[model samples]
Target: MPLRLGAFVHRRIIAPGALASATLLLAIPASAASYSPGAPGIGDPYYPAYGNGGYDVSHYDLRLKYQPATDELEGTATLLARTTQDLSRFNLDFVLDVGEVRVNGAEAAFRASGEHELEITPRTPLPKGTAVTVVVRYRAVPSTKQAYGFTGWHRTPDGGIGANEPEAAWWWFPSNDHPLDKATYDVSVAVPDGTQAISNGTLQSTVSRLGWTRYNWRSNKPQATYLATLAVGKFDITTGRTDSGVPVINAYSKDLGDNYGAARASVERTGEIADWLSGYFGKYPYNALGGYVPNTTTGYALETQTRPFYSPRQFANGSNVSVVVHELAHQWYGDLVSVAGWKDIWINEGFARYAQWLWSEHEGEGTAQELADHVYASHPADDAFWTVKPGDPGPDNQFHLAVYDRGALALQALRNEVGDDAFFALLKGWPRKYAYGNASVAAFRAYAEEVSGRPLAAFFDTWLFQPSKPGVSAARGASISTRDPGTKGAPGRPESWKKIAATNGVHEHPER
Candidate 1:
């Protein structure tokens, strides 16, 4: 028997009102051939209803058109997926009003149901392991909604930026909006001839006809839904390769004016930083390297797959080099080796924080150990930083200081336990082993213990699980020697950086 048929038979299939004769009822099995509705959610505790079940989406081909004058966005999404079980109906997370939906080239019945779910019922039942194609046409004015933070597609002063992280990908396109379900993307955007549109991966081509120009971009690597992005605006584009010969392209908003030169300089530094990151954390993971779309409306920066998005107000400051380091490092930790659930966000944030410290050390500012010890001593025992654990910081406080600060502190503690050589090996090995996949905190602990050839259950528990700050020896362990923070020079903006800040009218300061 088919796997789905057996499971469906156990559940209710017939109504009680149906009354049949004994002979007629006995003629057929109580559980006959019938397909069941796909599960509404993927069972995530924090975000239970965001990602749907019963189908594994492999690829998304999105064609979009934006009218800045009207703030309207129209999109056609083609999803290629495989049925994990016999599916009569499945859900695709969506927020925009849809015009039409099709299954395998035939019209399919669909309704906008629940919060951000587009439930679709195919004309015929799709058997388990069947390949399927779903196409949806939708149009809506791009708008931003507040979730963990302000995200979704936002209309800037003259253009727009898609900053969908967590569960906001459904705002612009229909998808299995979860990190665990990774898929490649082919995005094409049509905007006014004067504007530029950008997305992830390599730029395939650009064609202009009449008054509109269409931009084609492709991401061959598997990408989480949240990491996907699309930015349309009036941009100054620079196409070239990085210092290490990696194909690089950067798009900066023309709205910057005199500040545009500074933004371009910061973007040009991407290749150099890519080379520096490769030296410490193995080779560059992606094929192309460069995306620094400066949007003023966005208040923060995000590691959106191949290209990361930044805000001119926050990221263009002289301090952007460190900020750039943080987001770029995520290319390896968050983008390449993703977190399976929202709870494992530390693996992404903590690693990126540690990378900042490593970059500081490389620049002769301070060592990771020194920075770790200083941060540990600076925070009071009663501070909320220690109270909220990184593993589960609740939904609203997910990006709190604990995840970024204490999370890095935990890695530093582990480095103290395993020594420099073993710790670095683990850093390079972890991402390489689980490249383009997801891993949990428990998996990280087990992998760390395996690589170090020692037991660290107590060490992880004291820092990560406990609500209070651990003692110095507990954080550093007995094997590692304590380095005096005073021995290192006081942190200060370098003279060259100060000159850049003066010229750019921006300030350069280190992050907490």
Candidate 2:
């Protein structure tokens, strides 16, 4: 997910027949066998209907074909999963038209329900703990589909892109669309001969036929659905490796004009930045490290697993490695260790923002302490920036500036409270402990306390939970100072801080 500032109004469009079908599926007979219908939701407090229940997916094998001229996407998705309970029916988060569905080779009955659910009742109930293989064939014009008043599928002039935060997989593939259910992927996309398709992890091979070419990509590590991305377009691709031998593959759309040079300059540093980030945050989480810049009006960038997605706007003001640092930091916090719920976004955005501050210090721009002091002095006590609590910012305020900057401020405060050794140790140990899994804010707080050998309940409450500005007391830490409202105090910001703010500041509009 990218950093932007604004509230979003979510609207859902439900088909007329959807309600009746959903009602029928919910009516499970008590006298029947042990089998039951899987719950429609995975029970995230922020977005209850985001993910499905009853089965845990291990891998997704997607064979897809897209015709750029028609914007039509046809695919066969095979999911390898294990039943968590005896399930008579299970649901997958999807919006496109599903033509055929099979469970263990038997045809299953399925129908569209609500906005983005495919309700399927297999011929035989899936026994608990049994491994199951599900195959679905579907087709749709991804650009024409909308769920929750937004479309994750972006139609490029040459082809299309499947990329978004919290919700993107539904637009292109049937998935258990949430971070809690991480799975490996084998994405095979077929496009016109001249165009190219790119995805996560390693590119296994490319085979061309008469007029179409297929690109096969494999992600061996478990990944959240939203982190899986697909881009089909004409691009200038570059390949290299970090000093540690992590393969780096960067791509830029050929259609970009003047921004192409800056985009290339910033994104091509992916290898160097990843290697630099490895020093503070431990080793880079993925085997392949790189980024891509598509010719998109989307104003923000996203940490899409191995290959982060960059919007051209990020480089409009010349090379902006801060955004790259932000997204790459997420490869550790957001991609490697995901949020248990969306409200725990601070663990992702805040840590990533802090990485930008660290990068600034590394580049001789500003120290992390100086940046923290500058941000604290820049905002007054009465500013609404303090009102958005980073710990549990509501869904609309999830991407607010307060979440990113204040979240980083919270980390800086912790560094001031805890010794340098403990602070850095926690940062490096966190990803290793929860690597390739999901964790919550409370868990992180507990881990912080355990690692620092200090109870930080009050400190976290003041910095992350309270709506008002934190008091400048000795107990609250030494990073922030008390100042009269709207007064510039000691420790003035460095000159480079202005450039960083201009390039990475939270915008007035929401990012996709």
Candidate 3:
């Protein structure tokens, strides 16, 4: 359950008077006749100003140092990229105190333009397809900065955690912040001698100096910028290997008093759960498998790459393995195969929610068909939940409950329409075809049609895009049985659905 904050409005500073436009136009260099400034945004309809254009990043090497006591972060980021077009200048999503910027070893001019855009102009125009290196030196107190009424930095008593949905890298590191552009990462951080710093992928090395310890982590596979995360604090770390030989690492904050046992009870099963999910999602996609529970007041969990981030509040009521199933499923759906755009979010959340239902059936709590029937029968014909189109949920309702529950219902409906053999093949084949890349809902629909050998346009339109509850005829056409077969009575919900619903309460984001 990732936090769905308010929409981010890209703000700009406007100079006063009618001469403002002309003054800005004159600032361009007259010598640049053939080259032009790169677009500031990556051109996403939902969030236009997210990532930059003109360059495709291949790798990011970050060397950082942090002092939790002072809440200051200093870093040098070097990016290896290739130009997509002839460029005079480009932008990186960042908000920090920049001391210097260099492109291919020469000093480059830089300035802050929009709320999060750092404009950089190279000493020489870069030709299309030219290999380039960019280095930026910057420092900032992340918790003090806010863009568009939100800050993704989480401050704790002992240290800080850099993990959030939609956006977080702008607070700690400059990047091409969008899922459309993914690259491998090398993250190296230095903290106090006794403190620990954790990030994505495998731990490469650790070197201790006079009073600081530096830990280096590397991700070999392509990763979305938002999927990158960092946590710094005192922790109890446990390491092991899964049954399939994938590495497993779990960390918990040392101060998580009453929630420690329950958190461990649930997260300790990461290996077993991942092994089970592989039966349906093919081989586990990543070399690392694990999770971490940081002591934060935020009430949601994020599928942060290899190591998902869990809030202490998730375990407030004892062990909750259901949430673990939801997040781990994301390793394949959300992390490995990300949404091409924000509107295709149902591909990430719906598949993960369906995994939970599969886990419930595996545990014998309820069958998948039974759960779908109960959910369909519980919602009335006039309920507003049916109004949300999971395939294209608007930005404001991106993480609405319908996107999870109703989205899963849509999958169950598809399973009934396509039969188990083709449905299971689609589940296992979708990730394999699009591993380490971005995909859209339209692509998935076409893939489903190919696998099932049936036209799914009308079925998909009824389940995903329609604004009202589907008719009884449509439900029967999908083979959904709304009533228990054992009872000779009107439509009735299953008792197991009540138990499952009670365990998963409607989680909400805390005020930042």
Candidate 4:
């Protein structure tokens, strides 16, 4: 599922404040640099090409029809994008699967890329703030891994949805793809009678007339486009809450009766983690959270929005709730305050991976130090990790263990050095800072330095840009020598809800 090639770029992302020319630079090792902290890639600008970089997407409406036997979906997407410039050219990111494009009621010329990309040039210049109704007609077959890693519509044999990533939904619709470019969504899906369609928020109602049915789901909160998800098929899902009171859901196939037992422990544990995380990060970022098991083909799960897509066959401990906590934490970091682009994926993978470790710590799976030790052990000892940004991070860097795990460990170390108060405070501050827009590796480095009140350039250079893992003892020795015993033991902890307030210094939508 690797791309034939990556996009060319003027600047590569190295972490916040870590931008570099596209030229190769070998200084440190991040293990899986090909896919980790500082990958090199160009910006995937908002669709409609933001007419002279003037607009950002604020809302969207989706219409779709599904053909189960062939596993295909046909649909039209309408979007409302906000811009400050009067634009003549409009371009959107779409796969080769989509065809036919009309802009503001006029046919537009376009070209295709991959199975999921289309470049359209509009006929007339659209004035900024003049919301254009971009109507796109398209058809798509499910994928193993294509276009933003979305494998749409996993289902149980009974025809119930097991997992869906609205991020993956881009193949089905066109809008601002980043969580930072969040907008309201209204989805209308046509499915057969035996199936139920589930999306981001509450189910409003389903209309079934004329031998056709359309299920409409609406989300009022500011939603990162990727959070949009739809699961269709058959599976029995039980819902409840934990002692701490976060809602819990477990979905399993009909024949997997014994598998149901795992849900008991998983759900409760999820609830506990939910309460604890929300307590620190702020209220649960969304209205609800759920886990859908679509017969585990993959060993891992995604921390999508309220609905986390999972595969049951990957349940190793017979208790798969750790996946639950990992995804739930994403509601705050990834969903609410989204990363700006693919290069900043560590904002997603690193944090989510660390959340898993954090959960293990909370559950007594290990001490925080032990978790860090485990991650450090997993990092590769080669220079490839650092020399390569995402594009150069290495061929296997896309979510590779070395980059995601080891990279996250770097932040964990920073957290420990900064103390829990500063550490969690930074976590809560990040998303809020870049709410609804793109961020760069440079931005993250700056944020960390600001929050830690310490310069991290050298530190980032060592771990984030180096071509290989720094010797553990060397890293530890530096930490010891540079450690400031005078730094407050633990700064005052910020109340979780404190970050609920948006600040003005940084632009949430950088592309805007």
Ordering by lDDT: 2, 3, 1, 4
State candidate 3's TM-score.
0.91
Candidate 1 lDDT over 264-358, as tens digits, reads 66667888888898876788888887876555655567888878877676444443576677778889998898887888888888888788788
Where does candidate 3 clash, by residue pair? none
Full ranking by TM-score: 2, 3, 1, 4
Best by TM-score: 2
- Residues 325-399 of candidate 3 have per-residue lDDT tens digits of 888999999898998999999998888888989988988877788777776777777889888989998877788
**Where in model 1 is the C-alpha error above 4 Å?**
1-34, 144-151, 257-259, 476-512
Model 2 lDDT tens row, 1-512: 21111222245666877998756745965215367778788878888888888889999999999998888999999999988877889999999999999999999999999989999999888877789999999999998998877788988888888888888899889998889999999999999998899899999999999999999999999899999999989999999999999999999999999999999999999999999999999998778888888887877688999999988888888888888888899999999999999999999999998998998889898888888887787787799999999999998888888998889989988999888999999999999999999998999999999999999998899999999888778323555655543565566766568656754543323534
TM-score of 4: 0.72
Worst 10 residues of 3 by lDDT: 1-10
lDDT of each: 0.76, 0.87, 0.85, 0.56
Off by over 4 Å in 2: 1-31, 474-476, 484-489, 503-512
TM-score of each: 0.88, 0.92, 0.91, 0.72
